[model samples]
Target chain A: MSELVPNKSIYEFYRLVEEHHILLAFQGMMTTDILTMMGKNLKEQAEDHIFHRRIFSVMVELVQNINLHSADKAYSESDKKMVGKGIIVLSTSADGKIFTVASGNLIRKSEIESLRQKIDHINRLSEEQLRDYYLEQLRAPEDQDSSGLIGVARRAKNPLAYDFIHVDEEHAFFLLTVPIHQQNSDK
Target chain B: MENFSIKGSNYIPTVHFDAKSGVLEISGESYHEYTVEFFQPIIQWLREYLATPGREIVFNFKMVYFNTSTSRRFLEIFDMLEDYQRSKKGKVTINWYYQNNDFDMLESGQDFAEDVNLPFNFYTF
Candidate 1:
């Protein structure tokens, strides 16, 4: 809607989000780089036992999201963190109740609807159903192996909620708001 | 006392464990494809070391960053060290070091200390 030029406004807004709320922000040129920045961020999140298992599984989902949806035409999901190409943010909400992680990159207008449908479908399943499906996928071999969004759904199961913001249909930003597991809140 | 090294990929960290020096370091950037596969050998080594007995093992993690999969392996390694320390076969001293302002790394070391009941001297420069 605004100037195509990199908005100082966008960077400033990103700064505001990171300074005030983020537990971690995988900002500045994070496209489909599974090896570098985003992977680093996921690894940090998975440092804990809970994350080592559940959250990591969810991260697989996010990775898939990058793999499948990243609009960049030149790179695969498992490549470099292209400048001005990808943005992934991992953070927690103010109440400490939600850990929100999201990513964005260029994509085609035609593909957006299908991806939206996929995310919506994944989000609708019950916990039991989701778990069973996760197991099914787990047993199955890696067909696509992007960020395991389905895996994230069942494994990480956003504690708060998962949201998304579309920078137009051509570029959509996905936000996953997961709550801190209340059961393991002591740590 | 076997020497092993695994290359680090964009998605995983390389693990080089040296039994001769009794110096086992999980250093460098660690973001692995599969947590289980990458860490399985390190876990196996620690277990085998515990059984065989040897000099006190030293752990140095000058890691820039590690993913969740590697963290699990780190935990397992810490557990093995604790077991070694308690058995008294050899001493295990962990110098968990980090840069001056790497809060995540510092806190992570603290978290490990709490979990393993090991006295992790958290140092930052």
Candidate 2:
């Protein structure tokens, strides 16, 4: 019989991430405090000022989406709060010319279609159009479900790549990736 | 009415609205879980103040960062100010202060300025 070694698998996973130049990665319950701390860390670590602001802004919205809309919730050490469970990863390209932020969380199957539609709509807009849409949404009445993904698209200045994997009858795993190109100093 | 002032927390902004001075200021970062709930009272106070607003009102915003939820609330406040201005009740001025190097914050101020019909004075620190 083959031996099942869990420790080796865990070690390999970490080794893979380290080799990829991952700046930060977290998988588990996400809270506002944790989000703030992560933002601070990223701000301090990012070499480019513009990239820091864009990434920090985009990360805040992404994590907030997970916190507010994730179907899966886990109890934190403090019983007073219920944290949302999700995964967020930030990594740099092998050439060190691009940074990508990726996140995934469980969402209700019923909401996946609409969410997909919103991302598609955002992906199709021009930068000017996206800015106009963002302003329009800002003026509109509050919709809790809307995380203002257009704002994310504007900051990223790139298409939002996303996918949905069916988890079960009622839930699906939603994954989103945003790529921010690092501008050369000469430009 | 009594003046309202709440010290800023890690996730919520500091709100200082002085009834006597007619100087309303919101500063710091805001990304509260229940954004609307936290700002509802402040909105109410603004409404009440506008009913019999003083001669001059200056609203200052010096926010380092805020989530989309908080941005919506800000639009609401701007809408209210516009309404007050349309009524010609008093002179309303908005001071949007941003860090000198923070272009995003400057753009946010410009966005708000475009949406509302008011004299939005932008200051860079």
Candidate 3:
């Protein structure tokens, strides 16, 4: 390997993240310990108690989903083990009125259609319908589907935004974005 | 039966099941990576304890935050309690406590109450 200096690349990435108004960002292996630490840091950064809790709840669901569903894997140096790899970004609107918790992870191509349908279905439900649907899903058998995303939509009280960036015939990068309005935050 | 107690951490809830007193409680946060595995022994213990007939069980859930998977385990526990109560085997009451001003927590308790047949009482702390 040739010796290389990448200070410019580092600064460029920093500028890019800063330009996005990102409050917190992580890209690498996802694990329970890392999630706990990230949650604590995010909570401490927020001034409003309720706001922090709501955002924390959304973040937990998104991060854990990555841990459970992401098809990409990477070696975590600190953990000394391979774990799911993903990216999570917490950003706020320019007006500081809304916060968005977004995550990106690679997933198998076959899973994209079902995921799309699930998000579309969740987006269409009224709050009451969502609650009823959530409770209904809770009573269903333990299948790795539906409940978590429904919880995210219910807690957000807003439509979930998502995209599937096709990478190859067998895989795609899945991105999920959940928005939390500061005004509607009673929890 | 031996009393079952597991101390909590930042990611796991503290579970204390007093077989003698028949007051079972799970408090604190539960976002364990292996949530199903974590609750297995606790559920198994409840199963064995309920095998003995005519016992009154009071279940308290005071959770600060729990992941969706924990919610499923909670339902499993509730189903078990419902079964125990329905068969004339035992008397069961569930007390769900949520932090003051945390309506989400309160609603979570309510949703669980709606799903099962057991009697439920909600309290704000």
Candidate 4:
């Protein structure tokens, strides 16, 4: 049993995390309870209330995006329900000036085009335009799903970065990165 | 209808909608996952309350944090109030409370105010 695991790989994983300035990382079932717990812990790591609120709001939106749309699913006995599986990584720039919330989850390959178009459309908007777009979508209809991404972009005040890596004929690994600058606290 | 009240958690807000006083208040942090589903009954209660001809309504939104998903529902409530006021059935007032330094929250209030025709009072604690 001892031979099944390698010490060198474990040490390397630790080094990788340290090098990335990762504050928190979790990969597993995405449930509301899990979100609440993670949010509480993450809030504890920041002293500035306004900054943490921004991070916390972004984290909630990103986690819900996974919970609502991830193609990967698993049954959790503790939760007594089926839940989405995804990864969330919170890291800071080396200078500690910007915090990045990175997330990944499995998504249907069919969704790639639509997702790309939605994100690209958001990335092209100016700040004022983004706000107007958000309000416009919010007023469109309750079923519209585009407002979440708009809200995220508006709050982050930065273009979202994304990548879709094909994993199989039917599924792809979707990665989204949103950077929150600490200076935005003044805004 | 009797007074509607639900205790808040770390993720859900405390909702107190008084049918008698016509003062509906939602306070605390709200980041619930099933946002639409969670707010349905509350919205229904409002619908029922607004059924009568004349009833003064004071809606207080004392939220510290709510996700973007919740924003749509908030807008729905504002729209309902706007409609109610426009119909000349009752007087409506909205008091939006935010923390002193939470400008994002304040801006959200301002945005909602600008979107609707109802009176909105902004307060900071």
> Quick one: best DockQ, which candidate?
4
Model 4 per-residue lDDT tens digits across residues B29-124: 998877788899889988888888578999999999998888989999999888888885889999999999898899889889988899999999
Per-residue lDDT of model 1, residues A139-172, tens digit only:
3444342125554554454432544565774655
Task: Give each model a TM-score.
Answer: 0.48, 0.89, 0.94, 0.94
TM-score of 4: 0.94
Candidate 1 C-alpha RMSD relative to the actual structure: 10.2
Segments in model 4 whose C-alpha atoms lie over 4 Å from true places: A1-5, A76-81, A140-144
Error of 2 at A80 (Å): 4.5
Ranking by TM-score: 4, 3, 2, 1
For each candidate in the order shown, give its overall lDDT on alpha carbons.
Answer: 0.57, 0.83, 0.87, 0.88
Candidate DockQ values, in order, are 0.06, 0.47, 0.63, 0.78
lDDT of 2 by residue, A1-187 (tens): 9987799898998899989889988888877777778877887896776568777787888887787678999877742568688999989999988889999999999998899888898899997888788888776666643436887887778899999998999999999999887772112
lDDT of 3 by residue, B17-123 (tens): 99999999999998876677889999999999999888999999998888887888898899889898888579999999988877778888988888899899999
Candidate 2 TM-score, true structure as reference: 0.89
Q: What lDDT would candidate 4 get against the real structure? A: 0.88
Query: Residue A149 of model 4: what lDDT?
Result: 84
Q: What is candidate 1's lDDT per residue for B1-125, written digit by digit as tens? A: 67877777655556677877877766666655455665777788777767866576777777655544355567667767787777757778787877665554665576567667566666764
Worst 10 residues of 1 chain B by lDDT: B64-73
Candidate 1, CAPRI quality class derived from DockQ: incorrect
- lDDT by residue (tens digit), candidate 2, B1-125: 78999899877899999888889999988877567788999999888888984458899999888878888889899988888887857889999998777777887788889888989999986
Q: Model 3 scores what on Cα lDDT?
A: 0.87
Candidate 3, A67-105: lDDT as tens digits = 778999877666555678899999999898999999999
